[model samples]
Target: MSQKPRRQKHPKPPKNWQPPPDDKGTILVRRELDEYGLNIYEFRVLAHVARRESKAEGCYASQAKMAEVCGISQRTVLQALKTLCQAGILRKEKNEKGRTNIYRLNEGSKWKHPSELEKIRKAEESQEDELLNLI
Candidate 1:
């Protein structure tokens, strides 16, 4: 028997991305994550963890389930988890059953744009200048 073609998870966006005003926030998130270093898969993991169900005070997902939802291989999921953890974007623990690893997100951690770093540096410089004048 022949196997069906694999489904493509990240299809190109429509020619026109102008959505109704109500979907503006969702659009913004896609743009922001893209601006950052996250690819579609990475963003999905982050977005999922950011949701109420996933990021509650203490919530986690098994490596198996995460792999299924993210449509990636189990090994790929582990690598992604490592990247997220090193970036201070997610926290993880081994499941008690030893069957899977549990994943969580760090609430305060966020990826900032390169431009934002420049703005922060300029602000700090100005603040230092003002402090020097006062003294």
Candidate 2:
């Protein structure tokens, strides 16, 4: 009997990504944790949440589940989750049963990407210069 290869929980994207046939959308998130200056663990949790979410609906995963996948304790997961929340990258809702919390990416958040920092800085400088001129 031949054994089949086990499925990976997290699979890397292919070298060349081709759009889906129907163009519904792609959910393959292989983003680096530091893309937005986020901590690695926190971003891992964020990625996990994003993986489970759909464009139409925000999704939730249990702390235990995240911990199990990330090889960390529930406490660590919670801490990382909280960090993401405070950074405006994630929003959490307590489940009614109190088993675990539901998390979703705050995609509408004011949090700017690293690439936007320079543009924001320049804007602020211009604004300050205008203010100085008025003064």
Candidate 3:
């Protein structure tokens, strides 16, 4: 007997399908998270935390959870987090009950808002003006 063609195990997301919209704070955090000199693991961990951040509550993620999501050991996650906090790229605080840590992204001089891209344009304009003045 001929067998029917097997269906694909998992369907892909539609082209228009997107991850849940990030909160305003997350959008701002994403723009600044890369500025910190983070190794690959740290970057991944911070990105996961930023993705989970809510505008109302900020970022709250556990080391174990980050380890599971990144497929790394909890120790590695902890080290990365420590580095981030030391570098001032992230701020970590114990929760009210001291159960888990809450994280906050440090806003940088650059990429503070959606209009930050405009700052680049302004810089370009000023440079061009300087060149024109020199001419």
- Which ten contiguous residues of candidate 3 have the minimum total lDDT? 109-118
lDDT of 1 by residue, 100-123 (tens): 556676554464443554454456
On lDDT, who's better, 1 or 3? 3
lDDT of 2 by residue, 56-135 (tens): 55665677777777766786777777666655667777667666667777764445455654454456568768989999
Model 2 alpha-carbon miss at residue 21, Å: 13
Candidate of highest TM-score:
3
TM-score, one value per model: 0.50, 0.53, 0.54
Task: Quote model 3's TM-score.
Answer: 0.54
Misplaced by over 4 Å in model 3 are: 1-36, 109-135
RMSD of 1: 15.2
Name the better of 1 and 3 by TM-score. Answer: 3
